[model samples]
Target: MTHRSSELSIAFALLAAAAAFTALPQPAQAQAPAASQPTAAAAAKTGLVDVTGARIHYQLYGDLASGKTPLLVLHGAFMSSDAMKPLIDPFAASRPVIAVDARGHGRSGGVDGKLSYDLMADDAAAVLAKLGVKQADVLGYSMGGSTAIALAVRHPGRVGKQVILSGTSRLDGWYPEVLAGIAHLTPEVFAGSPIETGYKSLSPAPDKFGQLVENIKALDATPFAYSDAQVRAIPGKTMVIIGDADGVTLDHAIGLFKLRGGGDVAAATQGFLTEAPKARLAILPATSHIGIMAEAPAIAAMVMAFLDDKAPPPPAF
Candidate 1:
């Protein structure tokens, strides 16, 4: 099949998923969102810190005191830290991991307050400060990925090597259909989804799920994006990962990689030897927007490869 055909197929499929959002069956009961522990069994801690007009919620797995760089994991909009368990488990097993619930999300506060990507990124930094974490590697999915970019651009010192999963720096990076779907999102659409139930189970204000949905809609309506200079100026090395059929367009993903000093040339070309890209890009096959998050093991492996970064010695021929 042609590549364009595949993209259209994915786009239509994504639309179908979007339409199903409001049609999900209601849950029988709500329970506290599950706490995802490390596979290697590390000490776990949870905390709340004040940032801007909200209280941010976070969970730390593994030992902070070990002094190894921590990995900050940010969930998609309306998703709790708990829902990121698949990605968290493997990273936690290796080094420290911080899973955050953005303001007005999960167990955090200010459900109806104004929010910007810069503000959300600042909140993550504030949480790090409260916990006395100086710097961390970041892995953000969807909305979290957008915030991760802001964090790197705004608080360069607070981030180490970073990974952006299914994230776009500009809103236009997403397909128009996807944005339309997001525009149509109503509290009723989440009446029975984990996004709603998780909020009910873990939010400090359990009765505010509808308000949270409204907040997300408003947040999406606002234009939140970084300039080309801002993206090019990010000090740390970066890796951008996406599913073949993700909401982020292939062109945008390629643009991000290029903006970050990647895809300058083929790796083995002589020109590449003089100027290798400090960034990396991966497009996973047979994966969609939602499917990418669930493929944690594979994703974690790619993350570790980037983190480890053992390059072969240059040939002398």
Candidate 2:
């Protein structure tokens, strides 16, 4: 199945699911504690760290002394650490969460050269070293997902558990149009325009549009490429999340399913028993490519539970 067809099938499935669950409200307590909330002494010790001439910005959440696995959340292309606000809130309440602004995005300074996944992975490793965190559960969304995979392959010891949200293992056979669209996005256009406009055209949401644009601009400035061999080389307890109705057709989903352990983006996520195998898959329902995390709290909750090493029931097909 091709990527485009797979996207379409997923979209149809999501629309059907949305019609059935339209009455649902936003999950209460979904947002993280406001900055005004009292900070634990441990949390207060947070500070930015400089890495490879770029001052990588990172904020540590929760009490590190608790010994819970620290989580490192990587944002997608053109997105800053702020993009992680939704997932970070709950995950930080129990274990320490570190959200980073990849170089040239958010607070991090840009460097001259083509952006590569290896370099981004190096940035992640630098952040881990700066925090004195020998190992951490790493989660990446979109572009960050590719980075996480690189980290798992390059610095296996630094990553405990790995999760890739809306991430793919290889760029091979990716929708050519998607790549062409991205390739044509120049840095000047990104700096002068509202980035969200382009994203909303692909997926609907206004809140994070500007930030998304900024991240996209950064990606343009630092173009990164990876090979399928590099992607498959990653070894860790890895989990992948994708929305069944992400506008891509079911053929795309089937192609993914044919990979070593891929399956429906929403229905295949039911086997994540904590005591059993450490890795699994999840295909969230009624979610598009962009809003998967926002529409499905269960997806985020599953991620949090996995990062925390707590057992949670897998997705019910």
Candidate 3:
């Protein structure tokens, strides 16, 4: 193959895999908002909450007690809260934004050999409880979105409206290529990349990036699916968002959406005569797993609108 063909092949491979967290803004982009909006640092404050097996680090923007439900933002594997700024900035403009750096990632510490989504969910709840938030909305991307699913599933009362962006309910929901790519998520692949630099800059155990990867791999290797009954039992309004060309299979996305009470034939037959389903699904065009967060502001707007569920009576002015 020609050099350009090889490059294209590599690019396509990356697109086919959820190889890494997709939303790391270029260091220069920190100051460059995708739109005219608050920077990540605007009104932001940081904290660490002690939880079993982890000292979870979190950043907050806006006031938790400002009365609007806070939006808890979680980053994917190898990403820091900095990665969530796109989703955070828009939410914080209207409500509190609680961005957590999950165990062994970013500034969070106290990594254990058994760090699962359940543990991460509990850690997030502990932080919210510490801040006296009984319940808040959740918006998580990638692995963070899986953590959000675990949170809503395990602690239904703690999550109000939940948004799962590029998250999977079952490991098999991922395309085979993406599943195979997990083994490539070694520290060596990330060496000298922002994933490494970001961890070193923010992690208390900066030397443990390799360990973090191993632990995450272990977590991934563990069985991670809930029975259909368990998923349907959760009593929270949920939205599942995915890119059309994402690592997640469209069939899996639709199945998960249907499991969450997504739209059905009732809508086509009777429009307003029927109530909307509690679940929402969005499939963005021309997007892939790696570019999911490139349009963060737009995604945030959809999430905000979903959570802001107030509605006027009807077609009357």
Candidate 4:
């Protein structure tokens, strides 16, 4: 979702209702709309609905005739529904595809001045319920990846399969300096000043450096700490993907990889496969965190294939 500068002001106002101050500068561009307003041409073939609480926006494509399980795409932080655009056309051609703007991003509404994974999970549930979808193959990228895990834990019945891309089971010690830097920024700086230097250490594309900086700033600055035991409890088919070069010292991705066991795609793959034998991991050679999505079509294809396999069989003639 793209937001105009004016809408950013409104969003800041809304966000401030719960907190006393803001942490990030507004992006130079307006906030993307709450949802993509597809053209009539696209609308006829798709369904758009606003889930309750106005916190979830979903677009459904493809008919149930295929009997294929629906695929739900969730985006990373500070990103809008458009982030999943690359996979939508291909995935929707065979099975139903639904992409959402998580609360506080894109077109989704924020909860009463606070952002919590539980609330985000609730928003996902609301969207699924609104569509009357019993189960879906889910894939979340980056922040959405964590949100997807929360959904599986909170609403296991609704998840047929799950994929976590460049995501983590816990947030503690992930990026202390980055988080602290974001918290230190004043609302005025967040809304008008350039982003701090900490963000540059993580993002590959430094062109929109300020935007990336502000995005981290706008994210739920509240510290998030999750338990390893809590993550192990998530039930369903699952996979974890990460690049070798992610993090300050390559520790971010390496740590998560090690947490799964031994920091190799094979080891992580085996861990997940042991639980859900069908689960697998793909480590893109020479790919970094940000570069993985754009540079690694194979990874995306693998995810699409997993969703396809989980989809219900096509309807009979």
User: What TM-scores do the predictions have?
Assistant: 0.84, 0.68, 0.86, 0.64
Q: Could you give candidate 2's per-residue lDDT for residues 63-178 as a string of tens digits?
A: 65687878899976655565566567666666788888776555566433335567788988988898789999988876687788778878988988788777654553234445
Clashing pairs in 3: none
Q: Report clashes for each candidate as comma-separated counts.
A: 0, 20, 0, 16
Q: How far off is residue 222 in model 4, in Å?
A: 3.1
* Model 1, global lDDT: 0.78
Candidate topping lDDT:
1
- lDDT score at residue 247, model 4, on the 0-100 scale: 25
Query: Could you tell me how far off, in angstroms, the CA of residue 77 lies in candidate 1 after the best superposition?
Result: 1.0
> Taking the tens digit of each residue's C-alpha lDDT, what string does model 1 give over 1-317?
67554544553444333322333332222111336323543546898998778899999998889979999998887777877776787788888899988888888887778767888899999999998998999999888899999999989999988899999898888876676566666676556755666678889889988787677667667776798999999987899999898889999999999999886666746543543248989998877787676466567767887877645346687
Candidate 3 lDDT tens digits, 1-317: 87555543443345222323443442333233547664554757888998877788989898876888888998887777877766777677778888998888888996544678888899999988988899988988878888888998898999988888988878778776555556546667666766667788888888887897777667666668966897888787888999899878899889888888886677647545234358888998877776677767567666766888743135544
Encode model 4's per-residue lDDT on 177-225: one tens digit a residue.
Answer: 4344444444354443222222222223433444443445545465564
Model 2 gets an lDDT of 0.60
Clashing pairs in 1: none
How high is the CA lDDT of each candidate model?
A: 0.78, 0.60, 0.76, 0.55
CA RMSD of all predictions: 7.3, 8.8, 4.7, 12.1
